[model samples]
Target: MRALHVITGLGVGGAEQQLRLLLRHVPAQCDVVTLTNPGPVAAGLTADGVRVIHLGMRGNRDLGALPRLTRLIRTGGYDVVHTHLYRACLYGRIAARLAGVRAVVATEHSIGDTLLEGRPLTPGVRALYLAGERLGRATVAVSPAVAERLRRWGVPGRRIRTIPNGIDAPLFAHDEVARKEARMFYGLPEDAYVVGGVGRLAPGKRFDVLVRALAELPGDVRLLLVGDGPEQETLRRTARALGVADRVVLTGERPYLPDPGDDAPGVVALLSAMDVLASPSAEEAFGLAVVEALAAGLPVLYASCPAVEDLPPDAAPGALRVTGGAGAYARELLRLRAAGPGGREAPQAVRRYDIAYSARKLMDVYTAALAGSTLEVSSP
Candidate 1:
C-alpha cells in the first residue's frame, strides 16, 4: 500500500527518530511531509532514499499550508495517511480528509498529565486536539498509560490503540570493547561512574533535577546529557551553578543510526559507555532511551516513566521506578550502584518491543483501518 507520513517537523527528537525507524520496517511505499523545520532527521530520511517534502509553514497560524498539504495528499494518491506529533495530527488529519483518504491514523508520542510538547496542557489545547482526533480513524498510543491519558482527554476508548515504541535491540547489546572505545571518544576516564540521560534538553525532562542529583552524588560520578534543545543553555548554567559543570558531558544533538547495519555505533556506543541510565523526566509518554538502555544491559532509574512502570518487574529486570526529584533519584542511583552490575541480559519481554514486531502490528492497524474494523485498545 502507498502510505504518506506527516509530522510537525523532521527534528532528531524521539518521535521524529521513531518515524525514521518505523519507515525502515513498514512494508509499503512510504513518503514523508514535514510542516516546518526539516532538521537533521530530514537529511537522514533522504539518505535512506525516502522522499521528504517541506511545507514551510510560517507558524502555528499558517493556514495556507493546509491547501498545499491537501493538494499533495490528493495528487499523490496515497492509500493511507499516518500522522505523528501534535501539529501534524491537527493539520494532517484535516488535510487527509480533504484529500478523501479514508485510512487515517495518528500516533500520540508526547502527551502526559504534566505536559504536552513541554508546555502545560491548557483547556484550549485539549479542545483543539479533540477536534483533530475526530478526523482520524485510529489514534496509536506509545504505551498503555498514554492510551488511558487519551481517553481522559475525551478520545473515545474504542479509537485508541496501544502500541509500545520499539527499538533495534541487538544494536544496543553491551560490549566491553565498545564501552572502552566509546569512553575514549567522549573523553571520559575508563573507571568513571557514568550516569547518562538521553533526549531533547527540555524543561519537562527535568534535566535540572538531574544536575542537582549529580551534586548530591560523589565527585567521581559524572553526568552525560545527550540530545539538544531550548534548555541547553539553561541546563549548562544550572550545571555551573551546582558546581558540577566540569563533571557533566553535554554531547549536543547527535545523529542516531536507526538500522543495525550502519557502520557508525551512534546511540549504541554512547549508551554502552555509561554504567547506568537515569531518566528523571517527570513527563514521559514512553521512555524510548530507557528501553534502549535496558537492551544495552544497563540498570535504569526512572522517575514517573510509564514505559518502565507499565512493565512487570521481571520484564525489565534492571529497571527501577522512583519518585520524582533530585534526592529521590540520587538515592536510587546509590542503592543500585551498591548492588553492583547484575550482568543480566535483556528480558524476553523486551523482545515484544522489537521494531519488527511493531512493524507487523502497525500493518495490522492499517489493514484494519482499511477494512473498517473497530479498533480496540490492547495491552503491550
Candidate 2:
C-alpha cells in the first residue's frame, strides 16, 4: 500500500525520528509529507529515498494552504495517511478525507493535558482538533498515558488504540571504541563523568532543572545538551547565572549522524559515552532518549511526571524520579552516581516497543482502518 506520513515540520524531535524509522522498516512503500517548510527531518527522509511534500504553512492557524493540501492528497492517491503531532493531524486528516483517502490515522505523540502545563484546552483549538480527529478512521497513541489523556478530552475510547513508542535497541548497543571516539571528538576528558540530555530546550522539557542539578554536581561532571528550540538562550543564561556555564556543552541542532555503517557508529555512540542520561522534562508522553540510553545499558534519571512514571521500571534500575526543582534533582543525581554507571538492567524491557514491532502494530492499525474494522483490539 502507498502510505503518507504527515507532520508539522521536519524538525529534530521524537515524532519525526520515529517517522524516519517507520519509513526505514515498514513493509509497505511509503512517502513523507510535511505541512511546514522542511528542515532536518525532511533532509533525513530525502536521504532515505522517502518522497516529501512541503505545504509551506506559516503558522499554526494557517488553513489557507488547505486547498493546496487537498489537491496534493487527491493527486497522490494515498491508501493510508498517518499523521503525527497536532497541526499535521488537524489539517492532514481533514484533507485526506476530502481527497477520498480510505484510511486516515493519527498517532498522539504527547499527552495533550501536559502539552501546555495543564492549562485548560483553548476553545477554538480544541474544537478544531476534535473536529479533525472525528474525521480520522483511527487514532494511535504512543503510550497508554497519552491515549487516556486524549480519551478524557472527549475522543471516543473505541476509536483509539495504544501503541507504545519504540527504539532501535541494537542501534543503541554499547560500543567501547565508538564511545571513546565520540568523547574524543567532543574534547571531553576520558575519565570525566558525563551526563547527557537530548531534547528541545523548551519550558515543558524543564531543562533549567537539569542545568541547576548539573551545577550542583562536582567540577568533574559534564553536562551535554543536545537539540535546540526557543529556550536555548534562556537556558544558556541560566547556566551562566548558576556559575556552571563552563561545564555545560550545548550542541545546538547538530545533524543526526547517518546510519550506523561500519565506518561510524551513530547516535548510540553518544549515548554509550554518557555515564547517565537525564530526562528532567516536566512533561512527556514517552521519552525516546531514555529508552535509547537504557538500550545502551546506561542509567536514566527523570522528573516525577505522569508520563515518565509509565516507563518500564524492570528494564532499568535507574529509571527513578526526582522532584521538579534543582535541589531535588541534585540529590537524585548523587544517589544515581553512588549506584554507578550501567547500574540499570539490560533494556530487554523495551523489546515489545522496538521500532520493528511498533511499525508492525501501526501497519495493523492502517489495515484495520482500510478494512473498515471498528473493533479495537484489547491491550497488547
Give the whole-model CA lDDT for all candidates, comma-separated: 0.87, 0.77
Local accuracy of candidate 2 as per-residue lDDT tens digits, 1-380:
98888898888787788888877878887887798869877988888888888888889778787888888888987899898888888888888888998589898886556463223457776777788889998899877777887888899988899887777777777778877997887777898888888888777787888888888889988888877888899988999998988888777664446444434324666777788888877677777777777777887788633334565565455567666688887887788778666543455575756778777888888889999898785444
Q: Largest lDDT belongs to which candidate?
A: 1
**Each prediction's RMSD to truth:** 2.2, 2.7
Candidate 1 lDDT, 234-307, residue by residue in tens: 99899999899999998877666534454434677888888898888878898898888888888988876777
lDDT of 2 at 320: 72
In angstroms, give how far residue 191 of model 1 lies from its true place.
0.8
TM-score of each: 0.95, 0.92
User: Model 2 lDDT vs. the true structure?
Assistant: 0.77
